[model samples]
Target: MSESAPTRPLLNLDALFDNPVFAGGFGLASLGAVLAFARRGAISTVGLIRRRMLVNVEISRQDPSYPWILAWLSQPREQTSFLARRLTRINKLSVTTTTSVTANGPTRASFFLQPGYGRHVIKYKHAYIVVSREKQATAKTNTGEPHETVELTTLYAHRHIFEDVFTEARALALQAHEGKTVVYSVRNFDWVPLGEPRRKRPLGSVILDEGVKERIVDDAKDFLARRQWYVDRGIPYRRGYLLYGPPGSGKSSFIQALAGELDFSVAMVNLSEIGVTDDKLAFLLTKLPERTILLLEDADSAFINRRKREADGYSGGTVTFSGLLNALDGLSAGEERIAFLTTNHIELLDPALIRPGRVDLMVHIGGATRYQAAQMWDRFYGDVDVDGAYRERFLKRLDELELFGEAKEGQPVTRTSTAAIQGLFLFNKNDMDGAISMAEGLIPPKLEAEQ
Candidate 1:
């Protein structure tokens, strides 16, 4: 190769500047200074100016405060903004488990979940307070005059470390007996899930016998007709139904079937499991989605027993009466929400709760009858074509089984079941045919007697 002038490797300035030995000595000192400044909440002069300008811009967007600023600055007078004055009073009061501070003064304290922001700081003559976006704080009246503690951290860290603590604190606050005028808005009753369940069983997947399906379709048709009528008249469209039957008689299944038939979502609430006050109950109701089927399962017992106990005997006696009234027909019970109440004993329900307007329909799902049993047998055996003698024998027995009702005038004779015999036979693949035949045999004699 020709002897060429050696080329420098791009002057190597970056390599020289990035020497680990030099970096270790200089970077540590610089980092320590920055940390000290941050701890003291001291911003550089240039950064302070920039922040002031940004805050002023935010203020100007709200109103032309220039005139007031100039007046106050020129006169050297102290004046507090409305927000500042309000926050000032909020900072003074100590809250205990049973007390709450009003917006008017620190004397009134109420328990509230600290939002995404960190604990509130009272400063600047109590006229200015800082609420950080990092942490959250809540206050409650201490029963033993205990002082409140303010937590400080970023929202991410706080949520990770103190979520359970916050939850328990919130629960205690909700349970505390504070004598205050509770104002429950109708919107509060509406409830939406914070996060959807990772695994959800679809309502449509519920298995129902043909007889139940027919009943659901019939009820849906009737409901739709009435709903459409109301819509035509420009009235608030609302319907309430009470489903009362023995447990495991498919009361829940029937409701699910109706929901599937109507193409509506079922919002189920176990009144017994809802551990909240009347105000919270109203909040949940108000929050319910429109066009939804609000199902209160076991509502009779839930209201009379479970809820009553939670209300300290006030619920069943008087408080629950008032609370239920508000829950059912209050201003929040908007026009489009449909309600269904299911109970094993309708007798336990208060008349006011199930009155004409509140519960428009009372459906009685009694024990399965023989007619229902025959239909279930038919459903199990319908597809199989037996020999002529067997078919004739089956028909005769079906008629006598006492499960078939007279077809309504001008309507097709649809086989319907009065019992859950299908469920009984669904898993018995080996005995299904024989069991069905036996059920048919019971029917023929009843048909002969009726004829």
Candidate 2:
């Protein structure tokens, strides 16, 4: 035998190309493209830095515009986007009519769009939709209390895209309330936004001492206009006031009026209310919008004497003294905003709550001054100007009643509270003489009741 031909080991040619068919049909270039696409898909699904963010209705109330955003996003559209993709959740065996109220409008029967998934294109990128639902007992139903499940979604996207969408959504929300004022309060441990009152009292309507009014207005103007100044000085752009005085002294009224004048919103935080814990307070305060007036009514009673309150059968809630102080000095404590703590007993307040950095001004809205009484008269009587004789007569009546007697030269007049005078006017109904006669009975007792 010819020197036995050395048998060459059988070569496995398929090993050269991991996927022989792909290489054969598409060639190396096309195969490379296919592999690249698969790699990208895998990265996007697991390795790529796509991010997810949650905006829970319960928690996001901290951001005032969150509700508006949800409304905007859920608004029903008459027509779908040309580039949109629709998803059908389930096909019903028989078509049934239904009516549902949506932000855009009401939908009846066939007019309703099927619940489905959709995408919205924003400036930066596309936002995908994924909804979650949980059965919850809701008080906001017309039917005999029913257990219903509502759908809420947490948006997912690249970080930049989410930021861009949020920024735009917030801008739109602010614009919606541009020339209007909103009242915000903490409800169920969340900030609830309420529209401006049907009848708003103008800032000019508040009959404050002339000097006090001027100072407040000037300070507000300076604070709101000094964003750059605060930034330059490394100062937290915030201001606080302690509106301490007797009840019905116009503390609350002044705040409401100030909101109107400044075109700002009012956020009322009542610490004595149920569920007002330290965390909730901090969240509410930190999330306040720019140029808002945060009113903490009855600040003195807000924290002190909590155990005594519990013992007295008051079951609302109690905030620890340290917690209140921490919240005031917390993350959201300092911003480009103004806060007012209205109290009947400033003496009961802790020193920390009224420390220098926390309270910038202390305004004592005492009983109606002679001038203030006159202004109240002009307002109720619809006068464009003060009547010297009417004012003098009113002042005389006040003196006879032992209300704040006429002021000494260059001194502020002391008198019964504005509320007392207001009650007299309200009871008499535009009868100046009648109100003057009833004013004495309306004088609050020398020792006023606790708020």
Candidate 3:
């Protein structure tokens, strides 16, 4: 047999290269080895370590750093990175435009970047920022099904570079949210993420007594600035505010404005929601963002007749009064959290829940006052370049309603709510006289016939 043709090896080298998967994997491994050999010296050098940070979308309800990293990577002026090419495509793609209201108007639009791997350079900071998406397998479900989740992985040149990158990224996110106010409400008992922000009355636009505004804002600033003070005294760096007011007052509006003013995100919690157990509440409170303002609206409804529950020997509710108290006391709360408990009926709350340490500040948000009415009117119509005659006509009608005269300093005031006024304005948009007339008609008759 011609000595079996000299018995060439059974494995064919050419055939191995013909198989794409095998060839590709072999090529990658060879390249990795070569790189490792070439960079041996550089790897030995001190102070050149590559560091990585992971940001997840599920853990603690989507780490904020992930969005911050995206914002940093999407910088339009970054020319020397892979992200530049993708960003250019992103800008060119005809995507849906999301409009949000701001102090300026609803003209501002936000576009979310598509998720992918991108290389970016932080010029001033002298670092390479590489972002990648990582898919992980989650625990099996009750049906014995496997699930996959995606998270963001951010790699930087060094640990120190990560610090600078995060600082700048956070600033960028805050800038993007400027002049816009977001409202967050509890979802799934464990999620306190933000909802779509509506055009809200700014801090300056919402009318509260000058003293009240000053006290709340100044106190918040002081509290934020006093973190070290609290640590020094071994006190938990937490504070609470109680906003008790009738429905439609500036309670929620003021909170929204304060969130915008402070550049702090809001995370609202509703205690009465299903599945809100003590442990879940604690987890939610402790996992809130550091600079978040937690709003627990309708506290009375959440903890109705706590005293009665205790006296009647009943131990049932989605959340017990003790659980709420513990959550508010910062037992497992975030280090730098401020909470607001709002109610229309404060007396229905258990005294133990709103005691001195639990509620540091109590603010009563009554109906809108004269200054508020005038401010709302001016804010709504002052900017219009409408006919001077029509403007005067609207003002005369507004004055005729005398909504401004309902409240006076040091006197009991019966007034309409800012929400009621805003509703009237919305229904009669661009018709100033109609808004004023409808606003006047909103006051209910004093005596109602028995139903």
Candidate 4:
């Protein structure tokens, strides 16, 4: 009797949505509750499956493995791959920066393709694998480039799949760079690859004065081999070579060959580059890539206006001289490094910059010598001057015209560069006589005037 009295206003469908026990807008409370429960159950079931039956991995753009994976996937159809060909179809594709010299002429730079930024699938060894690539701007590179992450998922039993995939990818990447030199340059405080790997320049190709190449190579090898010695002595494991002379004297070439000989990469840093400051320089020096030789080209010219830039209030991040010095030898100086500085005007460089700890070895990569000319001739003709006959005749004519530097008892000779000599040889590659006839161009202006 009491319950019947309380139900005087009978509940209807409209009453159900008036902020009832489970309030819902528009839809009735019962329908909304049912939908919510189903949605939650679906989410829970999916999560449980992911946790119990699936395995996953995440690779950030910062990781070296990231490129390995991308490179593996982006390989063209003509190339051989372990899993790339197994992918039956990938509708979503992205164009990448990598390129190849295809027979196609002057087309757009869409030579390379990879799975675009979305969900992708691959069939590897008869197992299904899912790839999800996502980009977020919450993090940025030095140049404000978008940061990305790739997530890979597969069955729980396929955990070893990642190791195998990455292993093969890394090997492929290394094989591409094998027997080639990787040149790096700084961009926005980070070292980036400068260009396609250069065909390795053989050490024998760079013909220096006798004992010069050997001495430099031996020192670098010895220094690299004696890491424990430097550590024990509490000395920073750093070595610097200052190669100073006129332009085209093989200063840069020798460094490249040296790097190739030592199986090392080269990082070229222009200290006076815009936006390069004391802090940035220090940061770059500290974070140099491993097994890389730091090459500071035109060191003298780069810093000549360091003070002038500051005084003029040039807002660009110009490097300070003090910053350069500190980066070379201060607390921020990197260990296990080989530094090469090439300058056409060594005399203009500050003495402080070439001090003991900073510039350990000062080598003059001067003009081509009689020894160099002869060796280069033999090499250019693809023959050995075993009898010294070709060298004698070639050098004899060079002396007659003062093409090679004049030999005097006490006077310093102004000689031509190996590059210049090689250029002349190439101009008359078929005719040694033609090369000799063109030898007058090789004479230094001072020698010509004095004669």
Q: Evaluated with TM-score, which candidate comes out highest?
A: 4
Report residue 306 deviation for candidate 1 (angstroms): 11
The lDDT for every candidate, in the order shown, is 0.50, 0.64, 0.65, 0.80
Q: Candidate 4: what lDDT?
A: 0.80
lDDT of 1 at 4: 89
Residue 263 in model 1: lDDT: 52
TM-score of each: 0.44, 0.62, 0.64, 0.81
Per-residue lDDT tens digits for candidate 2, residues 1-451, read: 5777788758655765667775686587788899999998988776343333533223132235444545444444443554443431222212224354555886534332222222232222354443332334454332233333323334543334445556776776767666667788765544556633324467777888667777887888888888899899988877888888777778888888788788887988776665676556776676675667888776776556345334654534655565566656567586677888888887888777888668888887777787788778877765622445655677788777666655565545565677777778788775767766666675556533421
Candidate 3 per-residue C-alpha lDDT over 1-451 given as tens digits, one digit per residue, 9 for 90 to 100 = 4555456788998998999999999999999999998788676553244322422222111455765665565665545667544533432211224665677665667676543432222333343333334333564442343333223233432446556666887899777667666566666533434545555456887777547888999999999999999999998888899998789888877898898788777888776766565667787776676566899877876565243345655445566677788788856765777899898888788878778778999988877665565566666777773444544554566566554454455533644567876777778778876765565554545411211
Give the RMSD in angstroms, all C-alphas superposed, for model 1. Answer: 25.1
* lDDT value, residue 302 of candidate 2: 58
lDDT of 4 by residue, 55-95 (tens): 99999987878878987866544324655655546788887
TM match of model 4 to true structure: 0.81
Show how many residue pairs clash in every candidate, following the order shown: 49, 3, 0, 0
Q: What lDDT does model 1 reach? A: 0.50
Strongest candidate by lDDT? 4
Off by over 4 Å in 1: 1-235, 274-277, 302-319, 385-420, 436-451
